[model samples]
Target: MTDETWSQLLAGLTNVTWQSLVMIAVGCLLIFLAVSREYEPLLLLPIGAGAILANLPLSPLVGEHGLLSVLYDIGVGNELFPLLIFIGIGALTDFGPLLENPKMVLLGAAGQFGIFLTLILALLLGFSREEAASIGIIGAIDGPTSIYVSGILAPHLLGPITVAAYSYMALVPIIMPPVMRLLTTKQERAIRMPYSQRQISQRTRILFPIVVTIGVGILVPFATPLIGCLMLGNLMRESRVVERLTHAASNELANIVTLFLGLAIGSTMGGEAFLRPATLAILALGLLAFVLDTAAGVLFGKLMNVVSGGKFNPLIGAAGISAFPMAARVVQKEAAREDYSNFVLMHAMGANAAGQVASVVAGGVLLALMAG
Candidate 1:
C-alpha cells in the first residue's frame, strides 16, 4: 500500500481508545433502554446521542463553544432549563385531584421524610454537607426538583443525579406495587373510593396556581423561582385565553428544552469525571432514598387508614412520593388485584399530585437546611 493510504489507516486505528469505545457502548445501551425497553425515551434518547457524540474521537461537541458546552452554559449552568421544564410540567399537571382532597397534602409531606433521612445517611458516609443535601433530594422523586437543587448545590454530580432521579421515577410502577401490596391487607385494597369528577371552573383553576405560588413563596422563599415559573405555566394553562402560549409551553418549548438539557447533562459524563467511587455511592444512595420514601408513604397510609376507620387504603399512601401518575396507577392496579370493581385512581391521583408539590417544597427545605 502507498504510504499515504497506510498513514491514513494507521491514524484512524490510533484514534480508537478503550475509554471512548466503552462510552459508545454505554450510549448504545441507553438508547436500547429508551427505545426497546420504553424507559424515559424523551430524555434518554438525547442523553444517549450526546454521550455518543462526546465520546467520538476528536468530536467538538464537548469542546469550547461546542453545541453541548454552549447549551450547558446557557441552561444547566444558569439553572434555566430545569425551571423551564417545571413550567411545562405545571402546564401539563391537573391539580384538581389535590385540591379536591386537601388532606392528602399530609401524605405528601410524610413522603418527604426520606430526604432528611438520606441526608443524614449521606453525611455519615463522608459526603460533604452540600453534596449530601443534593443527594438527599433524590428521595423527592421529582426530576426538576432534583435537578434544580443539585444544580445549585452540587453541579458536578448533576449527570448521575439527574439520570438516577428519572430512572427511578420511571420504575415507580414496578417498585411501588409490591411494597403497597405487602403493607396493606386484601380487604383494605378492595375498599372503593369512587371518582367524583367535579367540574373545576376555569376561574378556580386559574386562581389555584396564583394562590399556591403565593402561599408556598411565603413559606419557602428559596423555592420561589421554581414554584413561580411552574405556577405561571399552570395559570396560563387554566386562564382560558392563553391556549397558544399554553400549547407552546407544554409541547414545543418543553420538547426543545428537554433536548438541550439532556444533551448538556449527558456531556458531563466524561469517563474521567463519571468513573469514580463517589458516583457509584451516589447511585446506591439514590436507590436507598427512593425505597425509604416508599416505605414512609406506605406507613403514613396505614396511619391514615387507622384514623379513618379503614376508609383509606394504605396502598394509596405509596403513591405519595412524587413519581406522579405512575405511582398512582400502580396503586390503582394493585387495588384491582384484590377486587376488580374497586377503582382508587382518583384518590391515588390526589396523593400523587400532592406528592409532586411536596417534593418541590422538600427540595427547597433541604437547600435551606444545608445552606443555612
Candidate 2:
C-alpha cells in the first residue's frame, strides 16, 4: 500500500494524543471499578466501553449518525430515557410503608437540602446559575433524576454530572455507613421502629398516584413530566389489569433504556470537552453534595428522634438520599449491627422511596428558581 493510504488507515493511532490516552485509561478504570468492585457494573461497564470508543480518533461510534451519537440524540438529547426509566422504577416501588408513616417524607425532603446548599457553593465557585443548579443536583443520588435535571439546565455539563451522580450512587454502601455511625449513638441505631402494618385499600393505591401527579404537577409545574411518568408506571402496576405491560415496563423496557442511557452518557465523555478544570470542580462539588446530603438527613433524623422520644432510628436518615433499595438495605445492615432483631428495612425503604419523590421535586424547584 502507498504511504498515504497507510497513514490514513492508521490515522487513529498516528493522531492519538496524551489526552486520548488518559481518557482511555480512565475508561479502563471505570471497567475495573465495575468488574472488581461491583460498583454499578450495568452502568459503569457500558459507560466505560463507550468512553474508550469515543476517545479513539475518527471513531465512528461517536461521530454523526454513529451508534453512540444517535443513542445520545434519541435518548439523552430529548430527555426520554430517564423518564422511561422512571416508569420502571415506579412499577417496582411500593408506597405502602411510606403511607403508613407519612412523617418519613420529612427525611426525604431533608435529604435534598444538599442540592440547594451545593447550588450556593457552585455559584460561589463561579458557575452560572443554571450550571450551579445542575451541579447541585448530584446530591439527589438518583442517577436518572440527576441526568434529567442537568440535561435540561446544563447540557454541556451532563457528562461530568452523570459520572459524579452515578459514581457516588454506586458508593452509597460505602459512603453512608460511616455517616450513619458518626451521627448517631449505638443506642439510637438500635432503636426499633415497630412495623405498623396498615392496610391500604386498592382504591387508595390507585388514587395515590393520581393524587400525587395532580398535586405535584400543580405545585411544581416543571416537575409534572418527571412525576407524571413515574406515577403512570405505578398506576399500571397497582391496577394489575395490565400485567403484561407492567412486567415489560419494569423489566425489559427499563433494561433497554438503561443500556442506551449509559452508552449515550459515556459518548459525551470526549477528552477534549471532558478533561478540564470544570470537570474537577464538578467531581469535588459532587462529593460535597453527597456529604452534605447525608449530614442533613442524619441531623433531621436526630431531631425527629428527639421529638419522638427516641422512637426513631437515625440510621434510616441515610436512606433518605434516594439510592433506593441499596440505601434501605444499608440502613437495615446498620440496624442489624446494633441488634439483629431490629428490622427497619421497611421504614428505611419508605424514606428511600420518599427521597426519590423529593429529589424530583427538588429538581423542579431548582428549575423554577432558575426560570424565574
Candidate 3:
C-alpha cells in the first residue's frame, strides 16, 4: 500500500486520545450495567451507545450537522425532549393516590429540601451559581427535570449532571433503604398504613390536572413548560375521550423521545468535558443530595408519625421523591421485610405521586432563582 494510503488508514488509530479511550470504557461499563443489572436499560443503553459513538476517534456523529449534534439542537437545546417526556410521564401517572391523600403533598415538599441545601453546598464548593443550581437538581432524581434545568442554566456541566441524575434515579432502590433503616427503628419500619379507598369522582380527576397546571404555572412561572406538558398528558388520560392520543403519548411518543434524549445527553459526555475534577465533585454531590433527600423525607415522616399519634408510617416518607413506583415499591419492600403483614404500598404511592409533581416544581423554583 502507498504511504499516503497507509496514513489515511491509520488516521483513526493515531487520533485516539487517552481521554476518548477512557470515555469509551466508561460507556461500555454503563452498557454492561444496563444489560446485566437492568438498571434503566431503556435510557441507559442508548446513552451508553451514544457515548461510545461520540467518543470514537475522528467520529462524525457529533461533528457539525452530524446526527447527534442535530438531535441535540432539535431537542435538548430547545428543551423539547424533556417536556415531551413529562407528557408521557403524566399520561402514565395515576394521580388517584395523591388526590385521595392530599396531605401527602407535604411529604413531597419535604423531600425537596435537600435540593436547596445541596445547591447552597455546591455554591460553597466554589461552583458557579448556575452550575451549583444544576448540580443540586440531581437530588430530585427526575431525569427530565434535571436535563431541562441544567440544559438552560449550566450547559457546560450538563453531561455530568444528567448522568448523576439518572444514575441516582436507578439506584433509588439501593440507596434509599439504608437511610430508611438508619432513621427508623424496627417498630417504625413496621408501621402499617391501611389502604383507604376514597371514591374520587371523575369530575375531580378531570379537574385535578387542570387546577394543578394553572396553580403551578401561576405560582412558579418557570415550571409552566414542564407542568403544562405533564398536565396535558394527564388531562388527556382523565378526559377519557382521547384514548388513542393518550396511548400514543405515553408509549410511542415517550419511547422515541427517550431514545433521542438519551443519545443527545450521552453525546455531551465526551471525555474532555466529563473527566474533569468537577465531574467527580458532581457525582459525590449528587449522592449526597440523594441521601439528604431520603433522610429529610424519612425525618419528616417521623414528624408526621408523631403528629398523627403513630398512625402514619414513616416509611412512606421515603417515597416522597420522583422515582415514582420504584421509590414507593422500595419503601413497601423495606416495610414488608420488617413485618410481612405490613402494607404501606398505597400510602407510599400517594407520597410518590406527590413527589413527582413536587420535583418539577422544585426544578422550576431553581430556575426562577437562578435565571437572573
Candidate 4:
C-alpha cells in the first residue's frame, strides 16, 4: 500500500477503541430489552439506535456541529422537547379520579420521600449536590419530569438518569408486586374498592387543567412550563374542539420529539463520557431510590389505614410514585390475586395521577432546595 493509504488506515484503527465497542454492545443490549422484552420500546429503541450511531468508529454524530449535537442544543439543552412532551402527557392524562378524591394527594406527597432520602445517600457516596439530586429523581419514576429536572440541574448526568428512570419505570410491574404483597395483609388486599366512575363534565375537565396550571405555577414556578404544557394537552382533549391538535400533540408531536430527544441523550453517552465508576454508582443509587420510594408510599398507606380505621388498602400506596397506569395496574393485579372480586383500579389510579403531579412538584422542590 502507498504511505498515505497506510497512514489513513492506522488512524482509522486508532479511533476504534475497546470503550466504543463496549458502549455499542451496551446500546444493543438496550435495544434488545426494548424489542424482545417490550420494556419501553418507544424510548429505549430510539435511545439504543442513537447510542449505536454515536459509538460507530469515526462517526460525526458526536463531533462539533454534528446532527446529535445540534439536536441536543435545539431540544434538550434548551429544555424545549421535554416541555413539549409534558403538554402531550397532560393532554392524555384524565385527572377525574384524582379530582374526585383529593385526599389521594397526600399519598403522592409521601411518594417523594425517596427522592430526598436518595439525595442524601448519593451525596454521602461522593456525588455533587446537583448530581445527587438528579439521581434521586429516579425515585419519582416520571420520565419527563426526571428529564426536565435533570436537564436544568445536572445536564451532564441526564442520559444515565433518564435511562435509569424509564428502565425502572418499565420494571414497576415486576418490582412493585412483591413489595405490595409483603406490606399488606390478604384481608386488606381483599377489601374491595369498587370503581366509582364519576362522569366528569366537559366543563370540569376543561377547567381542571387551567386551575391546576395556575395553582401549580403559583406554588412552584419552576413547574410552570411542564404543568402548563401538560394541561394544554388535556384542555384540547376535553374541549373536544381540537381533535387535530390533540392527535398531533399526543401521537405525532410526541413521537417526533421522542426520537430527537433519545438521539440527543444517547449522544451524550459517548464511551469516554459514560465509562466511569460514577455511572455505576448512579445506577445503584437510582435503584435504591426507586425501592425506597415504594416502601415509603406503602408505609404511608399503612398509616392511612390506621387513621381511617382500616378502610384504606395499603396496596394503593404503591401507586403513589408516578409510574402511572403501570404501578396502578400492578396494584390491581396484586389485589386480584388475594380476592378476584376486589378491584382497586380507580383508587389506585387516583393515587397514580396524584403521583404524576407530586413528582413534578418534588422535582421543583429539589431544584429549589439545591439552587438555594
CA RMSD, predictions in order? 2.1, 1.2, 1.0, 1.3
User: Candidate 3, after superposition: displacement of residue 158 in Å?
Assistant: 1.2
User: Who is ahead in TM-score, 2 or 3?
Assistant: 3
Q: Model 3 over residues 1-372: C-alpha lDDT tens digits? A: 999999999999999999999999989988998999888988888889989999999889998998999999999999999999999999999999999999999999999988988999999999998899999999888999999999999888988898888888889989999999999999989877778699999899999999999999999999999999999999999999999999999999999999999899889999899999999999999999999999999999999999999988898998998788899999999999999988888899999999999999999998998765
Q: What TM-score would candidate 1 get against the native? A: 0.94
User: What tens digits encode model 4's per-residue C-alpha lDDT throughout 1-372?
Assistant: 999888788875778988899899989999999999999988898888888889988888878888988999999998899888887887688888998888999999998899989999999999988888999988888998888889988998998998888888888888887777777788888876656677778888889888988998998887788778878988898899999999999999998999998888888888888888988998888888888888899999999988998888898888898987788898889888988888898998999999998998888777778778
In model 1, the runs with Cα more than 4 Å from the true position are: 1-16
- Cα lDDT computed for each candidate against the true fold: 0.86, 0.90, 0.93, 0.87
TM-score of each: 0.94, 0.97, 0.98, 0.97
| Top lDDT model | 3
Q: For model 2, how does the per-residue alpha-carbon lDDT over 37-103 read when each residue is reduced to its tens digit?
A: 9999988888889899899888889777899999999999989999999999999988877887888
Worst 10 residues of 2 by lDDT: 95-104
Per-residue lDDT, model 4, residue 235, is 88
Give the C-alpha miss distance for residue 360 in model 3, angstroms: 0.5
Q: Which stretch of 10 consecutive residues in model 1 shows the poorest summed lDDT? A: 175-184
